[model samples]
Target: MERIEGSGASQLVQLIRAIGYNSEITFELATVTSAPPQLKIKVDHMNVELEKDDLIVAQSLTKHMRKVNLNVKKKASISSTSIDSLYTLTLPQGSGEWSLLSFGLNSADFKVEEAELEFTDELKKDDRVIVVGMNEGQTYIILDRVVMY
Candidate 1:
């Protein structure tokens, strides 16, 4: 009976150890509000991959356009590793109104190798899309963490 209890306790401990903890992050934009754009803009969702072309919507602003900033905050129980050295952000162009934003997180240490905002008219028909990515040889980025606004 004692051995059975000990075995149960060990299994319980093992289960707890196997369960790794996950962090919850709240994304906050420092410059841009989450509110809908004042002007009509197409917001398309796409993943940011290296050397890949993505489609997104374009928004024409009747008012002055402001820079969009992203800020991540960790919950009290969690902490974030420093991303200062690791991550790149890119903007890709897509169809009429839809544009793409790409994020490249360094696989080695999370440093950003390429970050760009772009617009192209070559991929689809008449879509005004924006695409972003790293150069060819800089494929050492791994996207493990992400948040949507």
Candidate 2:
């Protein structure tokens, strides 16, 4: 059997319809900038009180007050199996108007699919770098092959 000299092994090449072979083309994309969602926490009642940690702040529409306290409690604690294990803020009224402001991740299971991997980070410890996939019973993270500086 005769072999071609100076030729590499039989390789599979991905080709585009109009574009020819993409062997020498490499993508060096610039960094990506993402802005987090703007979340507003407003108490629907005048007598509503809000507390993040040990400090407490009151919200009163009658008093024309509309600013939330910026102090956050800092502590180390293990996460609970139930979502309620994290701190639950008390709304003035409602069965449980408290939404999960942040979640802590004790452990995570990850998988790469189509060169994408998704994950979640515990806000308190992970500098909010944890990733999360938002789907009912499908909370998984999907990270793209792209990298950010």
Candidate 3:
């Protein structure tokens, strides 16, 4: 069993985190007669096999992949109001309706205006929706919007 260390291990951890898996990792080595040796990593809900060639390049790439910050400001002309309390809602694409899934409230159908939708093609099942309220009994779905900077 060859020990994987240094940047190789760091890149492996980063890849695991990128896939949204935050749990203990376990590594095991087993000999195979027909195939070349490879690293087998398993975590809850995920399984990965990494060969020696991929691991070498991944180590260098991971070192340079660091987070950077940017300043974001909303356009002045777009009038907006503060949301008192926001809740995340999820609706299946093309369903044409939404049902509130929290606070013991009855599920009701809500409509989303086409102009409010942003990145409609990238939506997935149960994707997050921002819920904003104008006042009690008045709520709106803050769909993805296209704004020109």
Candidate 4:
């Protein structure tokens, strides 16, 4: 394929790309909201209506390889007075404490166990993502994470 320069070239490139890949499969711009397994995406400029559970992710796109913000303050509990358990203060960030020692009591109320670790980072609202799906209403796979500048 010949490389062309400038804004016109980009669209041409996308068109040419379709020739190599199946034309039935097309790239689309979508907005992500909510969370995984129930992710809500709004496709731009298409009549096709998408819904929850309609999208599956490409594992590579969901890779934890990228460094991300750890998590901001929320309802967390204090685990101990010592520095060792200070990190757990951000675990649930609430007053779910239960310590007889009184000094080491800021922990989740015995309910937020291992489930907290299962939390997946969700794309912020209005973040744009690319999806490749068949026009025949097939399940769309998120190509990768994208941010609209």
Per-residue lDDT tens digits of candidate 3, residues 84-145? 55565566786565543334223433333333322223322222222222233122222221
lDDT of 1: 0.28
Q: Each candidate's root-mean-square deviation in Å?
A: 27.1, 25.2, 25.2, 12.6
Worst 10 residues of 1 by lDDT: 25-34
Q: What do the candidate models score in CA lDDT, each in turn?
A: 0.28, 0.27, 0.31, 0.59
Error of 2 at 20 (Å): 38
Runs off by more than 4 Å, candidate 4:
1-21, 47-49, 60-120
Predicted model with the maximum TM-score: 4
Measured against the true structure, the TM-scores of the candidates, in listed sequence, are 0.13, 0.15, 0.15, 0.46
How many residue pairs clash in each candidate at the backbone level?
25, 9, 1, 9
Residue pairs in collision within model 2: 117-143, 118-141, 118-142, 119-131, 119-141, 120-130, 120-131, 121-130, 133-140
lDDT of 1 by residue, 88-129 (tens): 344456333433333443332222334443332122322222
Report the C-alpha lDDT of model 4 over 1-149, residue by residue, as the tens digit. Answer: 55555344245436656566766776767777655555677877666547656787776644244433343243345554465432233225675754343443343343332232332455555667778776565678777766432
Taking the tens digit of each residue's C-alpha lDDT, what string does model 2 give over 8-62?
2111111121245343432111111221121112122213221222111122111
**Candidates arranged by TM-score, highest first:** 4, 2, 3, 1
The regions of model 1 sitting more than 4 angstroms off are 1-66, 75-123, 126-149
**Candidate with the greatest lDDT versus the true structure:** 4
Global Cα lDDT for candidate 2: 0.27
